[model samples]
Target: MPAGPVRTRDEVVTALRDSAGVGMGYVPLGAAFGILLVTSGLEWWWAPIFSVVIYAGSMEFLAISLVTGGVGLAQVAATTFFVNFRHVFYGLSFPLLKVRSPIGRLYGVHALTDEAYALLATRPHAQLTGPQVLATQILCHLYWLTGSTLGALLGAGVGLDVEGLGFALTALFVVLTIDAYRSAPDVGTLVLALGCAALALAFVPGGMLVAALTAFLFVLLGRYTLRRRRVA
Candidate 1:
């Protein structure tokens, strides 16, 4: 079958094959989110709904608890913003511009999951065609959808301890973090991140994640500005 307009069969196959690694990670992680959501008292159908609509990896897991616990809109918004604050940095390197069409670009941005970002980021940006990028993302999304659906169906039939399930995303992040550091080791950036975390932990223990992310963002912006000035 044709992958999409302007894409060859070989390219489509390659994209699908490349996305298989992402699928491997996403399936289990998505399943964990699915199992946690259902076990937390949400309907099995809600699993697919969340996977389709939200698609925010770690945040989706947190949303299950927030939704079940009857969190207010304000709290949910604040929590979501803080939890996903790191995504802002993702846009800096994401190949969003490679996607030619407006609709494809829109979906590309929406479907830019951590797995997709990691997979695509490893590839040379100029080497990727719009269809290849979109196809890979779509395949990853399908993997997540399939996993979540199956997991929700299974959770409905049997009881399981979901406490450990939450670690799936964490483990994925750890692996990704290691891969990122190995690819481009930077002591200054590592030290900055650690310093931010330390300051957050010391000053705002209850809001450490938010404080750390906010501080890191500002520090990154400052660094970028300084580098730009030096370049000019």
Candidate 2:
């Protein structure tokens, strides 16, 4: 297949501008997370550290409570796995194969946020290159880091009551879900997700989110297998 377009100066500038817009949404959310961390009894510095190291978006927000509550390492590990397991499907279709360099591919995997994935999923795969992908991810990461650090500083210097800040993450996810559905409207996928969620809520009340996602993955794989067999 032909590489759709050469990376031109204009293309790079456009990509940067596009990514900057997406990154803007992260600023307030990241700041909220930072403020929440400090308010939750963690040192303000932990905000940036978690943003840079954990980089798990909503999970990082949950981590503040987890760490402060003295959650066990085993439980934390299990939660992280379940929360991030969807990335396995993301990797199957993401343009990581276009990333030629080993280091670039490694960073691409590490930097794969919901925002980044949503942005890429909307684009034609042939049009994307490693540099463009990396540029977008890096910009988003910088926005998160800067916003979190600034919020931490503000929290440390002059504390503010940031009630309901956690809702921002939920709002972001809702927006991303809408965008993804609009990009690729698949009724089967939607049905599978809803069914799994319902079943999980009915049966595995404690682990609803993880159980739903796991069941959805299995159903999705089964569907893919049937489709492939039909094609063959």
Question: Residue 53: error of model 1 in Å?
Answer: 0.6
* TM-score of every candidate: 0.82, 0.85
lDDT of 1 by residue, 41-89 (tens): 8999999999999988877888888899999999999998887776777
In terms of lDDT, which candidate is strongest? 1
Count clashing residue pairs in model 1. 0
Model 2 per-residue lDDT tens digits across residues 168-229: 76677678778778877888788889999999999999888778877987898898999999
How accurate locally is residue 158 in candidate 1, as Cα lDDT from 0 to 100? 85
Error of 1 at 84 (Å): 1.8
Q: Which pairs of residues have clashing backbones in candidate 2? A: none
> What lDDT score belongs to each candidate, Candidate 1 first?
0.83, 0.81
Q: 55, model 1: CA deviation in Å?
A: 1.0
What RMSD does each model have against the real structure?
A: 3.0, 3.6
lDDT for model 1, please.
Answer: 0.83
